[model samples]
Target: MTDKLKDKIEKFLAMCLKSKSEKEGDTSIKVDELTEEQHREIAEDAVAITNSLVELQRLLPVSRKLAELGYLLEVQGKITVKAGEAYDEAALNFFSDMYGGGIALSKRLH
Candidate 1:
């Protein structure tokens, strides 16, 4: 990685190392007090949270777009998920702007 990232990581590691105060100023953040089962559980929990974070990152944009479409449709006073301009024009335009055109219209016309 870059020197800036490396420096930041080194600084963080230094901070972590200095988080303990015991035995004549020897600073070591040890998990020796923690049981092996607890350590395994903590690692499993971390991995689960990391996986959830990855999925959330992947889904956030799609969820945001869906929320935007819902808001646009509701502002135009329609909440139904229909498939045509007959229900909500603003929602149609919101999606058409992304995909370049309406799929139904393209299928019917071309």
Candidate 2:
């Protein structure tokens, strides 16, 4: 890792450690005292976790809408389970923006 990135990660770890120590009334943890391997491992894990959280946040809205659609379909008795599958393939096409437009255009061209 670049020195700048390592420095930032070290600073962030120190701040987090200080805050946690204050909350738990323990001041023994120090970022500067960590071995190089430990520090590198923590930094890598932190970045990976942050990326996963960001991806989940971005997908949350789409997932919510899909859930709502499923509920409405179930309530109306419009969807059925087949061989333990929760959703039908055709019903899911409704949520695709390109589905309707593409089908209509293809029908027109053919």
Candidate 3:
């Protein structure tokens, strides 16, 4: 999993584990409050992130989008290009393809 996706998962879990009232909410983990549709939506978002990362990795093989959003790393004093990270035509194309070959994925998420 990419760091970004891991972050999202962690955040979601934290939210789910939070209690509105330490008393009443202390009964048990109320994951049942989240409907099936809500769960499916979260799954969809995860899939989108995974697909985006896959394309990003393919566009820049030797890069590290898996750990960071933009791929600019120095190992042994060598630079690697992180594609689909810039606001250029190539990145735009990648985002478009990521969104079912249509619109661009949210810049903030990318």
Candidate 4:
């Protein structure tokens, strides 16, 4: 897929896939394009920082969208608060798969 297309798909996934605030909804698509591993890989990289603070802000909204938002690190299976963490720290702990966190895909999928 082209870069533009990838970005669009990623954005759609984020919006439709739902979060704590976004309730479950119907989403139907014939996704034979990307393999399961590919999908996982893309998601793993979904919250990557581009060295842009504006982009970084998405993972750590200053208005405290992440206030009630707590990360449930997969490996540890514990909730980490986002209240007072720095932007980078919040982003890393909240969305870094390498460290057992990231918008929990399993929770989002279910």
Q: Give the alpha carbon lDDT tens digit for every residue of 5-57 in model 3.
A: 87877677446446333545574555456667866776687688889999987
- Among the numbered candidates, top TM-score falls to 2
The count of residue-pair clashes in candidate 3 stands at 0
Candidate 3 segments whose C-alpha is farther than 4 A from its true place: 1-30, 62-110
Global lDDT of each model? 0.61, 0.71, 0.54, 0.51
- What is the per-residue lDDT of model 2 for residues 1-110, given as tens digits with 9 covering 90 to 100? 99998888778888767876799999986888877886687778788989999999998777767667766776787665456554433246543444566565457678
Per-residue CA lDDT of model 4 for 1-110, tens digit only, reads: 99999888767555434441245443443344446885676565554533455566665554354333333242255445455664445544555565555557667567
Between candidates 1 and 2, the one scoring higher on lDDT is 2
Better of 3 and 4 by lDDT: 3
Q: What is the lDDT of residue 64 in candidate 2?
A: 69
CA error at residue 21 for candidate 2, angstroms: 7.6
> Which digits, one per residue and each the tens of the lDDT, describe model 1 over residues 19-99?
533534875444555456755765576578779999999977767776677776777775555555342345555666667
How many pairs of residues collide in model 2?
Answer: 0
lDDT of 4: 0.51
- Shift in Å, residue 71, candidate 4: 38
- Residue pairs whose backbone atoms clash in candidate 1: none
Which segments of candidate 4 are over 4 A away from where they belong? Answer: 1-31, 49-55, 58-110
TM-score: model 3 vs. ground truth:
0.32
